[model samples]
Target: MSEFLSHSHPRVALIGECMIELQQHANGTLKQSFGGDTLNTAVYLSRLLGSAAQVDYVTALGDDSFSDAMCAIWAEEGIGLSRVQRLPGRLPGLYCIQTDAQGERRFLYWRNEAAVRECFTTPAADPILAALPEYDVLYFSGITLAVLGEVGRARLLSTLGDARDRGARVVFDNNYRPRLWRSVDQARQAYRAVMHEVDLALLTEEDEQALFDYADSEAIMSAYRDMGVSEVVIKRGAQSCLVRADNRRYEVPAHPVHNVIDTTAAGDSFSAGYLARRLRGGSPQEAAEAGHRLASLVIQHPGALIPRSVMPA
Candidate 1:
């Protein structure tokens, strides 16, 4: 299953927020963890690619103890924290996850004032914004766009344009949360504008269905294709994923598990594994299989990050 990719270490950055997460179990006991779409992807990407890539997390957080702990966690996962800012007087956001009997989770957020809100416009952000164009890849999500406010989002979109002009690939994940937006029309407009510069897209069927009311996966894929995204992946939990790249479409099946404990980060880990293979010169089909394999293992775990020793060797 091994393939040779470029020997040089590829630099990749995932742009988003990571918050303190409180997961309430069926017995009413709460387990604390850190979870976010882009953060989860960064962790898994670092783990999967090992030294083959340099993965950095781009965001802002407070100088509080919680922020320090999150940084420690990222360092332990081998993610570069140089681009992360520590703003004084601001704290990271806090959220809770409530899951049903089926392990499907619901998030309740209290992150409106997190320091990452000004990740782009703050005085400290000028250097970070300037450094972004140097990276080889930039990854982010819909939630990242929604939480950053209009000004911050505008700055990020502008940064993406500049980064892409410098040959950086923009990777997008559509992790949409309706509650984070002012209205469906506004969300649509924001997504459309940002996606115009996206080179790759990781889309969830349900999120797309809710955000754009697409008739089917093909419509969504076609829309992204028209927007100039060279590659698109559609993830359907416990079902096959649809991958289209270089004028070829691949239908890759997800690995199924009989017992699903916590569904946290399934998509994130999948993205990591897929990118790992792709960066190593594997075909899109091979990457999708790796994604399914890693995600299948992740959903069985209790938290966003599974023990590194327990991961695939």
Candidate 2:
């Protein structure tokens, strides 16, 4: 675990875009909600940590009813709204999810003009960028990089470097979405830009392979290791997760789930579980176990968020 989180009640900030989610049912009905990669992780992390840590979501949302609803939901989940920004005359992005018989999900997005695209580019963002360094942990994903565009991304990179210089741990999740970028080379360049400041990397094996063209998991791990990341976790759905922490390696098996429903936030929940356990002083192996346990339960549910009542104890 990173030394920044050694203190009790460490503060965490997750930067990304949260969109209006429309879950398409088999009967052609759409169930509306809110979800995003880092947002999903923030909610689950807040739930897992309870009052043990402070989780704040950093993003810009429109001054609309949907945005208001999003804030209400995050507050209910115990996520801090102090870092969230509200912009006028814009709306949050929208996405629709269609699930297959195998519980695999496909998404169609309408986010080109979302308010979060200007999150780190506006004048109001200066204070948020200045305050980010004060947090114990800073978390973001590849999708965040893609959505931030060039200017926003450049500002974010500077903030990340500053945050790291202040002894804060930077956690990166490789939630790659090819549709969000102009080309693979552009995505590669963006991802490589932030690698230097990342303390912990939570990557999906398939996404890593797709993003960097790594032959296998070993190559992916070797690449991040060479990038100077202190901790690396490879999440392979239904298979074992690979972890490299404290110069030690471990392969933790995933929990078995006979029933499959929706695989919306499996990886996000796993990251939340892993970070929650590791930050609370659990071993790497124990953290991976917790990740697997939570992920297995998430995939058995129907949306990005499962009912709080069904959460694991």
Candidate 3:
């Protein structure tokens, strides 16, 4: 159904923040880059779908050198920048990634004062919110909801409703971070409010367990069905991804990886791959395969954005 909602040349708009990323290497050196969950998904989707979709990112950033560089890099990846908001004298958020010997990653964030917290509250956001319904699809994650606060969350809910009414597909990813929200109850309220409006949900099993404390995958799937989500995909790392669509279920196994260098952006890339295939008129099973394939490759390399040259054909 989501695939059928788009025109021949679909326009995809992802709402979230991109932060200054610093990664520690084995040699005790730090490598700088820019990445966020939605941003990573946007880049990979742009690469995979190519001319099939017009991918855009919507977020607020400071008018600083880092922001400028981030925009330029996004443009180089062929992501649209028409919805990006530049707040004066404000800086984008920053985070550091440290990976242990097992390739597991940990992050330390400095984003309390990031400009994206004001994404839908500023004057410039009026146009961005208004323009959201014009896109064929609107993609956002749990983190996007957390940073918006109460006021901005209300604004977002209104916009999402309007967008859905205008025949736009609303896609959500459950990338839950417990530390971002004030309390579990508040987070659950926000998630429940938006769940009813979502057309497709890309959920992680661990996140669902952490947030809603579901007993198992069936419980999570039942919750999503009750929320009126037409399509649901549950991603389990190194395991199978379960897809429920068209009143049928499909389980696709994760692709095998010989070496795991870094686990960063694995789920983000998987969502991108799945969305890219779905937008291109593929079935749920096929989308899951594509997602697993891409994620397997991502974990074999370091950082969020892997080299374009190494992209699978």
Ranked candidates (lDDT, high to low) = 2, 3, 1
Decide which is better by lDDT, 2 or 3.
Answer: 2
Q: Give the Cα error of residue 153 in candidate 2, in Å.
A: 1.1
Can you list the residue pairs that collide in candidate 2?
none
lDDT of 3 by residue, 1-313 (tens): 4454546789999999999999988898999999999999999999998987899999999999999999999999999999999999999999999999888999999999999999999989999999999888999999999988888989999999999998999999999999999999999999999998899999999999999999999999898998899999999999999999977888999998778999999999999999988888888998999999999999999999999998866
Clash pairs, candidate 1, are none
lDDT of each: 0.89, 0.95, 0.93
lDDT of 1 by residue, 1-313 (tens): 2232334688998999999989887788998889788999999889988988999999999999999999999999899999999999999999888877787887789988989888887888989989999998899999999988899999999999999898888889899899999999999999998988988788999999999999999999888898888889999989999999888888998887998988989888888888878887888899899999999999887878888877776
The candidate 1 region of ten consecutive residues with least summed lDDT is 1-10
lDDT of 3 at 107: 97
Measured with C-alpha atoms, the lDDT of residue 238 in candidate 2 is: 96
Candidate 1 TM-score versus the reference = 0.96
Clashing pairs in 3: none
Q: State, as a TM-score between 0 and 1, how close model 3 is to the true structure.
A: 0.98
Greater TM-score among 1 and 2 belongs to: 2
Sort the predicted structures by TM-score, highest score first. Answer: 2, 3, 1
